[model samples]
Target: MEEIIKVEKLTKTYGSRKAVSNMNLSVNRGTAFALLGENGAGKSTAIECILGTKRADSGNVSVLGYDPAADRKTLFEKVGVQFQENNYQEKIIVTELCEVTASLYRKTAEPEYLLEKFGILDKLKSPVEELSGGQKQRLSVVLALLPEPEVVFLDELTTGLDTKARRAVWKTLSELKEKGLTILMTSHFMEEVEALCDEICILKQGETVFYGAVDDAIRNSPCNKLEDAYLWYTDMEGTADENF
Candidate 1:
């Protein structure tokens, strides 16, 4: 399979703290890849470095064969992103926000089509501040997807969503994956990863502890669930320094 994203010996530092140390990751085309880590575990920092929003102190990154730092303008045109916290102007109506987002890209899906697909068509006139958390998240996703990107970076896409809302988002994402869109996502929900990700990378203390197929990781664990496998892997001896 063709690789869509790659990071090699990536490192980022803030003064004396190494936010990400010697991290490596690779995501293939048409695959849903998960980046897992606890708070302050360098997940966000790594993402920033990969997205060209933050510079890595050391190492290299490539997305769709383009260097983010050198080709950010072109990169941004081909990729979409949804941050963990999406903040829109309080009074901007959903349709207006979507329109603004769509205008930025050379090619984009119709705002109404995206909104309807996410089950937020009725929110066309709703202000950002008035929508529920789930609705806001859906809107953020729709904005990210307006460009019809080949690769998407989603950070905590379902952070505050209820079960039904979460499932709805998951179904949309699954459909995108089936259509051959590459996705790199981060979430605290193990079940979400299990359901969507074909491969996962677990970060511990700014380092990768595990990177492999989801089923293989689960099979190696004492329990059948990914949550248990995650715990077991993180607690394993020398996990932080383990390569692959």
Candidate 2:
């Protein structure tokens, strides 16, 4: 498999606090990868640095062979991102938002097609602010797909979604993965990761404790399930730091 994203010795800090400390990982083309950690475990910061929205204090990051920090203009053309929190204009309707997003990319998928696929086509005429939390979450995913990107970075992909909606989103993403789109996401939902991701990197206190197949993680830990393995690893006194 070809590498689509890479980070090496990536470090970022705020005052005396290291938001991300010497973290490293790689994502392959056409595969789903995940960043797993508790809140404040540097997952978001790592993503920002990887996408070049936030500069790292040290180390390197590359996306699709481009230096994200320096080639962001080029990188943005091929990469899409759905952030954890999005603030839209007070009265912008869904279609208007989609139009504006589509204009930024050289090539785009039809917004209507994506909206309907995500089960939110009815909300097209509704103001973005009027949409429910789950509706907005679905809208964000639609916006991300508009670019027809080769790689997408999803921060907390299904955060506000109900179980049914979450599963629907997962199915959509899984289909996209089958069509050769690379995905890198962060989520607190272990089941989501197990369903969508081929590999994962579990972070603890700004450091990676484990990086490998999800099943390998479960087998190596004392627990028999991913959720339990994740808890055990994150709460362990010493870093497990296993890789395959």
Candidate 3:
């Protein structure tokens, strides 16, 4: 598969503190890659660098063969992003938001189709402020897909969602993956990653501690649960053993 995204020796810092250090990554076309880490582990910072939302202090990044920082106009056209904390106009209705988002791109999928896929079509006329957290999350995803982008970045996509809602979102993502969308996701839900992601990179203290197939990571850490494997790999709370 073609590498749709690449990062080599990427580094970023805030004042005297390093936020990301010598990180390297490659994500293939039509694959889902998960970025996992504890708080302050540089997951978000690394993602920002990749998205060109923040400048990296050093190294290279390419998304869809375009330098993120230098070719944002073209790069962003092929990618969609949903941040962890969603904030949109409080008074905007779901249908109107979809139309507005769709207007930003030259090419787009049907807004109603995306909303229906996310099970948010019923809320089409509801104000954003009147929606529940899960509904809002579904709306966020709907907006992200409005452009019909090939690559998407979703930070905590299922956060704050109930079990049924989370499952619905997962189903939608599975369909997108089948249709050849490359997804990069960050989430605290290990099960979500295990179910949806093809590969994963785990960061600790601003450095990558693990980057490989999810199955390989589980086997290396000798844990059945992705969360436990993550804990062992990152040496969280000193749980790492010599075998790991």
Report the number of the highest-lDDT candidate.
2
How well does candidate 3 score on lDDT at residue 61?
A: 96
Query: Relative to the unseen true structure, what is the C-alpha lDDT of residue 178 in candidate 3, on a scale of 0 to 100?
Result: 88
Model 3 RMSD vs true structure:
2.2
lDDT of 1 by residue, 1-244 (tens): 9999999999999999888999888999889998888888889999999998999999999999999999999998899999878768999988889888888888998888888888899989988899998888888888888999999999998988899878888898899888988999999999899889999989888888788999988776665678877877777742332222
Candidate 3: 10-residue stretch with minimal lDDT: 235-244
Candidate 3 Cα misplacement greater than 4 A, ranges = 236-244
Clash total of candidate 3: 0
Q: Which pairs of residues clash in candidate 3, taking residues 3 or more apart in a chain or in different chains?
A: none
TM-score between candidate 1 and the true structure: 0.94
Cα RMSD of all models vs. native, in order, equals 3.7, 3.4, 2.2
Per-residue CA lDDT of model 3 for 1-244, tens digit only, reads 9899999999999999899999999998889999999889998999999999899999999999999989999976799998868878999988888888887899999988988888888898999999998888878888887888989999899988998889889988988898889999898898899889999999988988899999999888667767788988788564644343
Candidate 2 CA-lDDT value:
0.91
- Tell me the tens digit of each residue's lDDT in model 2 across 44-115: 999999999999999999999999989999988899899878989959989999999998888899999999
Each model's C-alpha lDDT?
0.88, 0.91, 0.88
